[model samples]
Target: MNKIHIIGLGLLGGSFGLAARRKFPELTITGFDISEKNLKDAEVLGIITEAKENPDSDTDIILLATPADSLGDILEKTLNEIGENTLVIDLGSTKSNLCARAGNHSKRKQYLAGHPIAGTEYSGPKAAFAELLDGKVMILCEMDKTDLHLKEKAYQLFEALNMKLRFMDPEEHDRHLAFVSHLSHVSSFMLGKTVLQKMEDDRNIFDMAGSGFASTVRLAKSSPSMWAPILTENKENILQALDGYISNLSSIRDLIAKSDGEKIHQELADINKIRDILDLGRG
Candidate 1:
């Protein structure tokens, strides 16, 4: 009953295996990855006990950690391979599309859609750590559609990682994440591009950069392969988020051009209220 098979041995998959292993040592874990090197690396690193060719017939749970775009195909393939008793969960960032696919599966009650609201700007199995999920929030979408027993097992698995659980609708999850997570990544990538282009003409630009610059541009280091699909999958809500962000930037630029010092002060003061709610620590 403790056998678990994980597909896509990347950062999230590897992290889950490591976390689960440390917390539940008796469980047997196996994994599969499109990159065979990653599958082998995960096994060699003790993240998983072995490499899985397909979803294990006797596995109690299967975790899919592939990119958002490939989630539906992977989910479908795994559903065809696994038995009805096996529980499957996806850790993709986008939820609505994946949840929709799960809802139509013949073994739909055995599937669960989850997004762990935690990760660093890193990818691949080497980026995994046993404490990556500790105390992070795990959002389980469309819980009402999942079977009660599989839901209970998922809750236990997350509990073993010391994660907090939140239940939400899939579309609601996508809309909220587009503004908070997706928009932040898009902003970081753009900021990095702008600074890097400026640095080409001024070598001293980065010499003047501080921790603030590093922190703000950190997400720019994230895997393009991972983010490209996430942005594409959440396009609509992310487009709306971009519109709001761009409007704010245009407003600020206009104020600066007009030398509206008093207006700028008021605008900045209004934005500072966000700090009161967020523990960004001196941002």
Candidate 2:
């Protein structure tokens, strides 16, 4: 049986372990985590056959499931330990940096940079579920850097997990993710912060928080430690997106202040067309 070693057994890693084991019972799975609590939780949930503090154990594949900021360091150490036959893949949000860092390594051809665009506003082992990656998109960045055999291995694994695969350059991945994913996280976090600040005196947040508010602020519940580094890493593109969003908000507010009904109606109508373009349900 092939052995799969998962480092940093948090939500992403833990979920992968569970899903992989459920789908491929022949594979032996082991998990390693820096946090003892996370390791205990993974063991309790049967996400892995065993939990280890060291990642140097023998395994056919190593999944670096650490935060975006910590990926480089973990990859450096993991490369030093794993055999050439072991394929290393990272489940990180920001891929450009990690890809560059691993580019010149001796085992670079064995490493694949992957980002599964599937997660919840939660973290840690207990937050993992077997269905987390089901029907979601998995972005594989800079695949050319990986050997053909390793790439095929990764593709098959993600397919077995029921995820759709998409190829992307690392730089392009970061740029596009900044708008679609990172910006959403920022908007959600700031929205929640703004509401909380207002509620300091109002104390009626729950009253005003209908489904709309809940949906908009959902990502705010994400782990700050996980998001902070991602936002910082993709700061350039995120800043540009934020500027445009703020400018639009200011324009809308000014229109409302001036009571320019015609202009406001026109502006909303123009933007509402997005529902048609994106195939979203009626607003």
Candidate 3:
């Protein structure tokens, strides 16, 4: 890509700029964010070559890393502004709504619905790092709708970043992420809330906390502005996931209350088997 435009200069967008610049030093990277400081910081950090108020049509790639709720309108408007060959990719957490908005657009083929399953529970340009995307998975939805050449361009860029690629239907993508991704954030946030509520009564509570507690609640530190829209956009799927999670929690709660050691042991043992499926270090 000769010219790349990033709409959001936060963590993911800034990281993409850093990584893209690392791989293609000659390319011009321009960024735009609602927060002017983010654009300024991104430029200062050399994450992008410059900052812009609007995307230029001559750009080869436009990465939409905006909040989930704002993606649909931004994407539609971007498609309207870009050249016929410009490729647009969104890194929103939820996909179904934005994919639906692009479904019948004349320039739909130029846009790709994507989610990079990577990030720390941090926000802003300062939190971005080039290696954040290395070895991470980039999930692309509605790939069949993207133009062949644009898809190849996206694939080349992702491969250059050492990312693994996965494709899924937009509906299926939202459903699966609701369970594996979104639900975890909800759980973490609530867990942190519970602990903070207790800490209000006994400020020393954290004195007894350990690394395990810190790790478990780390996602609670994530930006509410970014997550609120994600949760709302995938409301139906997230609600179903919450139901399943609540049922599981209730079962464990009942087991503990009844002093059913055997059942509790069995439940934990069954859950531990998940380690065989996932390697925490890799993720």
Note each model's CA RMSD in angstroms: 2.1, 2.3, 1.6
Best by TM-score: 3
Q: Which scores higher on lDDT, 1 or 3?
A: 3
lDDT of 2: 0.87
| Order of models, best lDDT first | 3, 1, 2
- TM-score of predicted model 3? 0.96
Highest lDDT model number:
3
Q: What is the lDDT of residue 41 in candidate 3?
A: 93
Give residue 162's lDDT in candidate 2 (0 to 100).
89
Better of 1 and 2 by TM-score: 1
lDDT for each residue of candidate 3 in 1-283, tens digit (9 for 90 to 100):
7999999989999999999999999999988998878888999999888788677778889999989988999999899888888899999999998899899899999999999999999999999999999999999998899999988889989999999999999999999999999999999999999988987888764343675888889999999989999999999999999999999899899999999999888889989999966885475
Off by over 4 Å in 2: 55-58, 205-211, 276-283
Give candidate 2's TM-score. Answer: 0.94
Candidate 3 worst ten-residue window by lDDT: 202-211
lDDT of 1: 0.90
TM-score, every prediction:
0.96, 0.94, 0.96
Full candidate order by TM-score, most accurate first = 3, 1, 2
What local distance difference test score does each model get? 0.90, 0.87, 0.92
